[model samples]
Target: EAGVAQSPRYKIIEKRQSVAFWCNPISGHATLYWYQQILGQGPKLLIQFQNNGVVDDSQLPKDRFSAERLKGVDSTLKIQPAKLEDSAVYLCASSLEGGYGYTFGSGTRLTVV
Candidate 1:
């Protein structure tokens, strides 16, 4: 099975600037999730997608964050007008509905200046 893939690995942007991250989930997996991991806390689910449909996004900051899964294969997360507090590890993970451990990518580390 192909593992999740993310790009750039790291990014630095000024506060109020915009940044985006990409993700490619494992093949055959039906559930994909994006999480924001702050300095010390656990990963918080920002959004979830089951195929091309969004399953959950209650925790996502709608005012500045947006996400979409196109063709039900890959996804992107965008944050416009970034904030200093937004600096964190953006993790992408996938799991099968039946039951399986999630496979996480190395993650895109973002820093706000």
Candidate 2:
């Protein structure tokens, strides 16, 4: 099976800048999740989506972070007016509905200066 695809493996931007990361999950997966992993920390869930609808976004920082899944296939996460604390690896994962096995993308690393 093809793995999840993510774009722009790395990015660097000054504080208050904006950046977006793209993700294409494995075909046929119905659940998707976005995570943020800071240095020396495990990935933290940012958002969860089932199909084209949001299942959970409580952990997402609405003021600066936003994400969406279009037509339940492709997804994008954007951070606007980023802060120094926003530096981390953004990960996208997908799994079958109600399944625990998730397939993850390589992720996009963001650096805020």
Candidate 3:
């Protein structure tokens, strides 16, 4: 199966700066997700989108993190005033409507100093 696509495979920024990551999901996939993965830990789901609407974003940090999937095919995740603790890889994924096996991108590694 074809996989999700992500841009700027790596990024480095200072604390209190901002960064953004982009993703393009597989064709015909209705469910899209953004996950954060810190070193030594599992990926944490940050947001979910079904079609062009938000399905869940409870885990997203509203004060500094935001995401959008405007057309249901591409998405973006942004972090503003990034914190040192925010250094991690951001993964984008997608699946069929049932939430089963997901196709993930290569991920964007963000390093905050």
Q: Encode model 2's per-residue lDDT on 29-85: one tens digit a residue.
A: 999999999999999999999999999999999999999998999899999999999
Better of 1 and 3 by lDDT: 3
List TM-scores for all candidates, in order.
0.95, 0.97, 0.96
Kindly list the per-residue Cα lDDT of model 1 for residues 6-98, writing each as its tens digit. 976999999999999999999988889999999899999999999999999999999999999988988999999999999999999988872
Q: Could you say which candidate leads in lDDT? A: 2
Q: How displaced is residue 29 in candidate 3, in Å? A: 0.5
Query: Positional deviation of 34 in candidate 3, in angstroms?
Result: 0.3
In lDDT terms, how accurate is model 2?
0.95
Per-residue lDDT of model 3, residues 1-113, tens digit only: 56899999999999999999999999999999999999999999999999989989999999999999888789999999899999999999999874899989999999999
lDDT for every model? 0.93, 0.95, 0.94
- Tell me each candidate's RMSD, in Å, in order: 1.2, 0.8, 0.9
Mark the regions of model 1 whose C-alpha exceeds 4 Å error after superposition.
none
